[model samples]
Target: MLLEGKIVLVTGVLTPSSIAFTCARLAQEQGATVVLTSFGRALSVTQRAARRLPTPPEVLELDVTDPEHLAALPEHLAERYGRVDGVVHAVGFAPAVCLGQEDGLFAAEWADVATAIQVSAFSLPALAKALKPLMRPRSAIVGLDFDASVAWPAYDWMGVAKAALESAARYLARDLGASDIRVNLVAAGPLKTVAARSIPGFSQIQEVWAERAPLGWDVEDPEPAARAVVALLSDWFPATTGEIVHVDGGVHAIGAAIRPPAPEPEPEPEPA
Candidate 1:
């Protein structure tokens, strides 16, 4: 009952296996009214997923990169819920070339890199700014994160985007604090979701989690992370903001147990 009587907006719910899906379910079970968001073609997928939730809340159209959509968010929420108490930002993406590229970070051009950062990192603040008016004092904003402290394998430019996300959260927390709003992120260990599976080198990253995460890690279950998100959305951590709660089974606290692979040797220049 942590989120009792709260109105929460959960974006980027694609399927039942997604962490956002679990967060929405837990919020509802705890007495909160949870609304979801998706955009374009994925809207249908999110709508389908909504049917499986306990209450099957309304799914709004939100393309985090769309300025018009961001502008309309407050009005939409005001029409339906009047006010919002919590926001769960689970949206993130990078073009195929932006991740697991053979050229690594060099493979993506500025256009693609900007796209990744805008959609994944900037969207947090954009969504927050959009919803600020509708959010009541003591309202909370929680974003999903990965441990960006290290260079993750195959993550490429997406890794850079996540680092930006962490920084943005801190600044958002600082400025929003005066309004009684708190911003935090939950960095979860890798999970087996469609998005995770699509990343070519991410499985390699997951392979190390079992040994690195002291308490152990599960690449299939998102409930632990989702539960932490619910806790943050509640008043449990009244003064906690601009912090990252690692739900990675303590992986973020430990040193790497496995060594990274050696780089391929450079080819010798042709005889001239």
Candidate 2:
């Protein structure tokens, strides 16, 4: 039980297939008491997923963009656990306009981009700050991430937001280090989560990963990524923080595996 007796908060679980849901389930199997967060219409979806876990988890309402929800998290956790040992910030969203096919980068208005950044990136520090009072030394905070170091066809502003998330994780590591709280990101490869389906041509990225990830990749299975999140949440990564661990089948390390077209058979040679 890597997470034995730990109290963990997981966000963004909309379905059993969600990475967060898998994390919650694995966390419980590892002896942690898991709590999930959802808001409005998606709350029911998360609730259904929670029931499917080996041990059903409690669900809390938390719209990360809502200041009130942010302010109330500490109190919410205080009532049940008193202190939080780990938190998985598995939340992210961007408006349609911010995605490339709908509007592309230039056509997306600042407001839409701002929404993406605030929810996906800014919320990392916001969640950390909100939960600080309830966090203990050695507590871990993990966030879900997509590789933002390079651009993809349709990721657009969401990619930008993820880049910001990468930076925020580093800053969080620096600031929260004194508190002995760890902050890190798990940059997972594309998977068939509800969120990924919303991105236009996401399959393109999936195809790229299949060719590039040296260990190969699975767009359907999120368990590998979930396992990474659980590891970061456990005591194993005590000395590791402000890091982005790519669970993308090693795709992040090398250039595309797509071979150049056989040089056109050297143009039949200059035999004349």
- TM-score each candidate: 0.94, 0.94
Worst 10 residues of 2 by lDDT: 258-267
TM-score of model 1 (CA atoms)? 0.94
**What's the lDDT for all of these models?**
0.93, 0.92
- Model 2: per-residue Cα lDDT over 59-176, one tens digit each: 9999999999998888979987899999999989999888856557887888988999999999999999999999999999999999999999899999999999999999999999
lDDT of 1 by residue, 100-142 (tens): 9888988999999999999999999999999999988999999
Q: After the best TM-score superposition of candidate 1, give how far the Cα of residue 227 lies from its true spot, in angstroms.
A: 0.4
Backbone atom clashes (below 3 Å) for every candidate: 0, 0
Give stretches of model 1 more than 4 Å off.
Answer: 258-272
